[model samples]
Target chain A: MSDLNNGRYGIHGGQYVPETLMNEIHHLEECYEFYKNDKEFNDELESLLKEYAGRPSLLYYAEKMTKDLGGAKIYIKREDLNHTGSHKINNVLGQVLMAKKMGKTRVIAETGAGQHGVATATAAALLGLECEIFMGREDTERQKLNVYRMELLGAKVHAVTSGTQTLKDAVNETMREWVSRVHDTHYVLGSVMGPHPFPMIVRDFQSVISKEAREQILEKEGRLPLAVVACVGGGSNAMGMFYNFINDKEVKLIGCEAGGKGVDTFETAATMATGKLGIFHGMKSYFCQDDDGQIAPVYSISAGLDYPGVGPEHAYLRDSGRAEYVPITDDEAVEAFEYIAKTEGIICAIESAHAVAHVMKTAKNYSKDDIIIICLSGRGDKDVSAIAKYRGVDINE
Target chain B: MSRIKNAFENKKAFIGFLTAGDPSIEKTEEFIYKLIEGGADLIEIGIPFSDPIAEGPVIQSANIRSLSGGTRISHLFELVENVRKNTEIPLVFLTYINTVFKYGTEEFFKKCNESGIDGIIIPDLPFEEKAEIKESAEKYDVDIISLIAPTSEDRIKLIAKESQGFVYVVSSMGVTGMRSEIKTDLESIVESVRKYTDNPIAIGFGINSPEQAEKYSKLADGVIVGSAIVKIIEEHKEDSGKYLKEYAEKMKSAMKN
Candidate 1:
C-alpha cells in the first residue's frame, strides 16, 4: 500500500532511469504487481526460502553480551546463518524466481563485498539461470575470496575499473549491462535502492527478517524491543529489520551507516550524516555529493557500505522521524567486530559489526529490563582477512 | 523561430556531441568551431557528471577526463556564453538530472538562458519525472528534449506528442556506443513517433559511420553522432580539430545525400 503511491516515500523515490530501460522497468513493476498476489508465486518463493535458502534464521539471545553491556536484554537476529552467509539470499531467491516466471533466462547483479554476488550466483545456479556479477576492481582486490566463491558458483565476475572503482562504479556498470541485455536478462539489483519497484520489491522480500524477528521476540520476551538496530549500506537489511516495526510508534528504528574514518572527514560513506537531497542511481534520495552535484567517491572499510547514497525509503524514514540513522566509524566497527567475536563467539560480518558497534555504545543507556534487537546481517568469513589486516595482523586468505 | 526549430529548417540536421572540457575548456571551444566548420547544424555540449549511467565507455572516459580537468557546471555555462558570441549554431547540454538539480534547477536554466543554450537532453529524467525540472526549463525558454528508445513501444506517442524542440529517438536498447550494425526497426519507431508530433526526430546511439548516418537520416529528420566524435577527441586529444572536421563533413555530407 505504501508503494502504491508511485513507489515514493514522501517524494524521495521515482523512476529516473534512461528511456531505454523505462519500458523494461515498467514490465518488471507489472510482473511484480501481478505475481505478488498470485498464490503460485508466493508458494514457490516460500518453498525456495525454506528449502533452499533456509528461512526463519535464529534469533539468539546474546546472554554474555547482555550481561556485559549491563543494560538492555540483547538479542541477535542471526541472518548470518542464512544460506549464502547473508540476508542477500532472501531477496535474491525471490527476484530470481520472479525473473524465471517472467521468462528471463539470465540474471545480472552488482556487488560490493561480494555477499550479494555470491548469493545471486547460488540462487541462479539453483534455478539454472545464467548469472554474471559486476564488482569494482578495487573491491575485487579487497574481497578476493568472494570473487572466487562467485566463480565457483558458476557466475562470471567483471572487475569494474571506473570512477572510484567501488560500489558506486559497480552499480553504474551493472545498469549499463542491464540496458544492453534487457530482453533476456533481468537485473537482480541487490539493494533497496534504485528506481520504482526495485526499492519496493527488495523491501518486500527482505521484510521477512522483521516479520520473523517480530514474531520470535513476541513469543520469547512477550514485548517489543525498545529499539531495532541494523547496519545501513544501501539500507536493505536495515529496511527489512524496520519494516514490520514501523507501525509500532514506541519502537525506535536505528540504522548504522559506515563512517569510514569519521563523518567529519572526506573519507566517509555516512550519507545521512552529511548528505544533501539529490538524485542518482535512479532514486531521488540523500546523496553525498559536491557543490556541482557530482556524487562523491565515498570510502568505507566495509565495501558493502561504501555507497554515496542511501535507499529512498530510508531517506523518507529519516525525514519523517520514524527512524534514526547514525554513522559508525571504522574504528568503532572494528572494535565491535573483535568485541562480539570474543563476547559471544559469533564472528559477524564487519557490516553487521557497525550495528553491534552502535549497540555497544548505547546499550548501557537503556534500563536492565529494556530490550534491544541487533540484526546481524551477515557472517564474517569473507571479512576476516580484511579485519585482520586492519588490526595489524595480516593473514593471507 | 527558435534556434532548435531553425536547426531542422529545410535540411537533415547533423547533431555533433562532445564533453565540455574533455581535455580543457579552451580545446572544447576549438573543437566546437571544427564541428561547425565541418557542417554541424546543432552541437550537444555534455556537462561532465560523476556517474553517467546512460553513457558507455567512450563518453564515460570523456566525463572522467573532463571532471579530472576540474570542469564544473559554472565553467560550462561560461563556455556556452563564450561560444554564443561567435556562432548562432544551436547548443544544448547533455547531462544527468542530478547535476541540474544540485546546481539549483531554476538557477541552472536561468544561466542556460543567459548563456544561449537552446535545449537540454537529460538521459536520466524520464517523461514521468520531467515535472521536477520542466517548469524551470520552460521558464527559461529552454526545450526539455525527450528521448524515445526502441523499448519505448507504447509510450512513444505519449512522449512524442509532448516533446519539445526535437525528439531524440534512441536507435537501440543500450548505452551510447558504436556498434557494427543496428538491427532495431527504426523506420517503424519513427513512423509511430511521426503520428504524434511534428517536431524533428533525431536518431542516436551506435551511429558512427557516414553510411550509418546516411541510412538512418532517411528515416528521421536528423542524425546524432556522439561516441564516434568523442572517441576521436579521446584519440587525438588537443590535435583533434582536423579529424573532427573531416569526420563531421563526411557524416553531414553523407546525410545530405
Candidate 2:
C-alpha cells in the first residue's frame, strides 16, 4: 500500500476536506494506492495514454529560436500534440478510470481556462460515465468555445457564480457539488494541487511527461539540459516535467508564474512570489489572500494561469531551493505567444507562452551552447480568440 | 464544568446555530439573546468564509450575506465578547481552517478563550489534520469538536476516542442543509462511539423541525439544528430574533421528552 504519509510533500499537503467527504477521499487514496501499481490498471491506462491519446509526445528542437536568441539551444516537449490538445488529458484519463474502478457512475470537475474541463469531459464520455463540469461564469465567458466543446462531448456544464466568479469559485462550487453527491460521484480535480493523494496522484500521472522527455533528451543531447522551464498554473505540467529531474542535481528547474500586471501589484497571480502560506482548495500551499484570510481574486491574460493558490509540491520545491519560480507579466506572455508563433511556427497556449517568455527574459545570461527544455503544455487554439481580443482584433465567437 | 458539558445537563440539549453578522452585526447580537431566551442550551456561531465547502446553498448564501454586510473574524470576536457580558451559554465557532489559520492559530484560540468560545467546528479540518490546531486549542481550553458521519463507519471509534466537548454525529451524508428525513443509522453509530469514551455525543446536520430534534435527541446526548434556524433568519432578516425565539422554544420543547 502507498504510504498516506508520502502524500505530504514535506509539510505541504494534507487532507483538509469536510468530514462528509473524508470517507470518499480515504477510499480514493486507498484505490489510488492499490490501482496505481496494480498490473491490470497500469496496462489499461498505458494503452489508453498511448493508443488513444498518443503518448510520448515529441520533444522537438526549436532551432530557429535558439539561433535567433544566440544563447541556449531550446527544445519544446509538445504536449499540445496530445488528443484534447493539452497536457490535462494525461491525468484525466488516469483519474476517470480510477473513478470507474471505485464504482462512481458520475464524474465532476472544475476548470479555469476550460482545458481541464474539456479533457475531463472527453475522458468521461469515452469511459461512459455521466459527466458534469463546473466552470466559473467568468471563465465560461472567457473560454466560450471550450464551453461549447465540452457540451458537444456530452458533459453538462454548470456556470459557477460564486466569489470572484473565476477558477477559485469554480473549485468551491465543484467541491460543494461533490459533497452533495459524493456517494456516486467522483471529483476529477485538475492539476497537481488539492488534498492528499491528488497532488501525489497528479504528479505520478503527469510524471509521464518528464519520463519521456528525459529519455529523449538523454538520447538526443547525450546529457541533461542546463535548465528545464514550464509555466506553473496549479503546477501540474511543471510538476510532471520536474518529477523525473528532481534527482538530477545539476539541472536547474524553473517555474514561470503569471505576473499579471506585476508582482508588486495586487492583480498578480504569482503565488510563489507574492502570496503567503495558507490553506485553500484542500492544500496548505502558497495563496494570494488578503489580511482577513479570504482567497484574493487573481488575474492573468492567460485564463489558465489566473489561479490564486499553487500546488503544495511547488511550495516544497520553492522552500527547498530545488526549483526557482519567477514572474512574467501578461504583456510578456502575449509577446512570447507571438514570438513563438513566428519563430517556431507552433502556436503555443498563452499559459505555455509564459515559459517561453522566461527563456527570452533570461536567454542573455546562458552560454551560447547551453541547452534548455520547455514543457509546451498545450496548443493555442483556445487562446487565439482571447489573444485576438487582447490585440484589439475582436474575433467573432 | 465546561459550558458545553453543562449544556447537556438533565435534558437533551437543544443547540441553535446562526451565521454572525448575517443581515447585520447588531441583528446577530439580538438573535443570540433571543435564541438563548427561547431555550438554546448552546450556540454555534458561524463565521462567514468566502468558500465554505461543507455548507449547502442556504448556509453558503448566509455566509455571503454576512461577508457582504462587512463582517470580519475580528468583528465576530467582538460580537462574542459583547454577548459574553450578559450570558454564560456555551458558544462555538463553525468555520473553515483557513479562517483560523489566517488569524494565526495560537492567536485565534487565545482570543476564543478570552471571548468565551467553548469550542470550534471546522468542517474542513478532518480528524487526521486536527493536529494543525489541536495544540493551540488545548492551550486555550477550547475544545476542537470532531464530526462523525455515517461514512465514518470504520473510523468512528477512533474519532470518538479523542472527541472533545462532544462528537458531532452528522445524521446525513452530505453538506449542511435541512433534510426532511435523515436515514443514517445513528443508534448504531452512537453505539460504536459509546465504547470509546463517555464524552457526550450530539447529532447534528439535516436536523430541521422539532420532529427531527426529538427523533435525534432519543439517539444521542443532544440534537443540533442549524439550517432550519438559519433559514428562519434568512426569511426574517433583521427581525429574526422574534421568529428564532419561537423556533428555538419549539425545538427545545420537542427535545424535552
Candidate 3:
C-alpha cells in the first residue's frame, strides 16, 4: 500500500534496468503487487512458514550472556534455529512461493556463503520447483558442503568464473540467466538489494523477525528494548530486524559491518561508515571504491560479508541518521567468536560475530538495566573451520 | 527562438556525445569547446556507471578511461559548472539510474538546475517509475528526455507524451556504438515516432559515416554520431580537441545534406 512514487521513508525501490530485462522486471513488479495483497497469497505464505519453515522463532532471554556482559541485559532472537539454519529461509520461502504463484516452474539464485542457495534449494525441493544455483568457483571450493547440499536437494550448481569469481560474479551470471529465461524462471534474490520491489518485498518477508520480536519482548519485558543490533552482509538480517523498529523513536538500530583489518585499511566492506556513493550489481548504494572509482576488493573472514557494497536501503538509513553504523575488526570479531563459544556455548557465524563484537564494545556504555537484543543471525557451524584455522588449530583433528 | 530551439528548427543541431572525463578533466573541457565551435547544438555528457549494461565497447572504454581519469559525480558537477561559464549550449546528462539514486533524486535535480543543466536522459529509467523525478525535474525547468527504440511504437507515444525534450530514437537494437550502414527499418521507426509528438526527433547509435548521417538526417530531424566522434578523439588522445573539431565538422557537413 506504500506509494513507491513518493519514495517515502527512503524506500524508493524500483526496477531500473536495461531494456533487455524491463518486461521481466515489470512483470515481477506486477506479480509482487498482486500477490502482496491477495488473501490466497497471504494464506499460502503463512501456511509455508508455519508448516515448513517453523515460523515464529523464539526471542530467548540470554540470562548468562546478560550477566556476563555486566552492562546491558542481552536477549537473542533465535533465527539460527529456523529451517536452513538462518533467517535466510524466511525470504527464500516467500520468494519461492511467489515464483510458484506466478506459475514459474524453475528457480535460480546466486550465493556467496551458500546459505541463500541452500535455503532456496530447500524451498524448491519442498515446492517441487526445478532449482539451479550459481555460486562463485572460489566459494564452491570453500563451501563445498553447501554445494553438495544443493546438489542433494536436486538443484544443479554452476561455478561462476567471471570477474572476481565471487558473489558479485555469481550475481552477474544469475542475471544473465534470468534475462534469457525470464518466461519460466524466477531469480530468487538473496538479500534486500537488486532493483525495486525486491528490497521492499524481501524486507517485508524477513521483517517477521522484528514484528515477532517486538510482541514477544513486550510480553516478557513489558517494554521495548533500547537498542537492536545485527551484522550486515547484503543487510538482509539487519533489515529484517530493523524494519519493525524503524518507526519507533525509542529504539536505536545498530548495524555492524565487516572491518577486515581496520576501518582505515582498503580491505573492508564497511560501506555505511566508509564507502562513497556508487552503483554496484543493479542498484545504487554505498560502495568501496579506489581513487579512480573502480570497485575495490573487500575482505572478511566470512565469505558472505566479503562484498564491495551494502544494500541501498542501508545507505538511505545511514544518510537519514535513523540508524548508527559501526565496524567490527577481524581480530575483534574473532575474539567475540571465541568469547561467545566459550561463554554461551553457541558458536556463531563469523559474520554474526561481527555483531556480537559490536555489542560487546557498545554494551560497556550502557547500564545493566538497558535491554539489548542482538540478532543471532546464524549459527557458527559453517565458520568453525575458518575460526579454527585462524587460531592455528586443526579442524581436521 | 532560443539558440537550442533555433538549432532544431533550422535543422543545424549539432549533437555531441562524450564520456564526461575522457583521458582527464582538462581534455574533456577542451573537447566540449571544440564540439561547440564545430556547431554542436546540444551536448550529451555521459556520467559513467561501473556496470554499463547497455553500452558497447566504445562507450564502455570511454567510461573506463574517464573513471581512470578520476571522474566522479562531484567532478561531473564541476564539469557542468565550468561549462556553464563558457557556453549556453543546452547540456543533457546521459547516465544510469543508479547515479541519480546515489546522488539523491531531489538533490540531483537541484544540483543540475543550479549547474545550468538543461536536460537529463537516464536510458535505464523507464517511464513507469519516473513520476517523482518528472515532477521534481519540471519544477526546476529541467527537461527529462526519453528514448524511443526501433521496436517501440505504442511505447514511443507513451514516452513522447511523458517527455519534455526531443525524443532520442535509437537507430539500432544494441548499445551505443558506430556501424557502417544504417538499419533498414530506421525510416519506419522515425516515421512512427513523428506520429506521437510534434517535438523534433534525433536518431542515435550506429550513425557513424557521413553517408549514414546523411541518410539518417533525411528521416529524423537530426542525427547523433557518438562512437565515431569518440573514436576520432581517442585516436588523437594527446590532442583530442583538434581531432574532435575536425570529425564534428565532417559529421555536421554530412548531416547538412
- Number of the top-ranking candidate, with DockQ as the measure: 1
Tens digits of per-residue lDDT, candidate 2, A83-171, equal: 99999999999999999998999999999999999999999999999999999999899999999999999999999987788888888
- Tell me the deviation in Å of residue B6 in model 2: 1.6
User: Using alpha carbons, what is the TM-score of model 3?
Assistant: 0.74
Docking quality category of candidate 1 according to DockQ thresholds? high
DockQ of 2: 0.75
* Tens-digit lDDT string for candidate 1 (B1-257): 99999889999999999999989999999999999999999999999999999999999999999999999888998899999999999998998999999989999999999999999999999999999998899999999999998889999988999999999999887799999999999999999999999999999999999999999988899999999999999999999999999999999999988
**What TM-score would candidate 2 get against the native?**
0.97
lDDT of 2 at A31: 94
* Predictions: Cα RMSD each: 1.0, 1.9, 5.7
lDDT for B30 in candidate 1 is 95
Give Cα-based local distance difference scores for all models.
0.95, 0.90, 0.80
Among these predicted structures, which one has the highest TM-score? 1
The residue pairs in collision within model 1 are none
Interface quality of candidate 3 as DockQ: 0.17
**For candidate 2, what is the lDDT?**
0.90
Question: What DockQ does each candidate score versus the true complex, computed on alpha carbons?
Answer: 0.92, 0.75, 0.17
Give the alpha carbon lDDT tens digit for every residue of A81-187 in model 1.
Answer: 99999999999999999999999999999999999999999999999999999999999999999999999999999999989999999999999999998999999
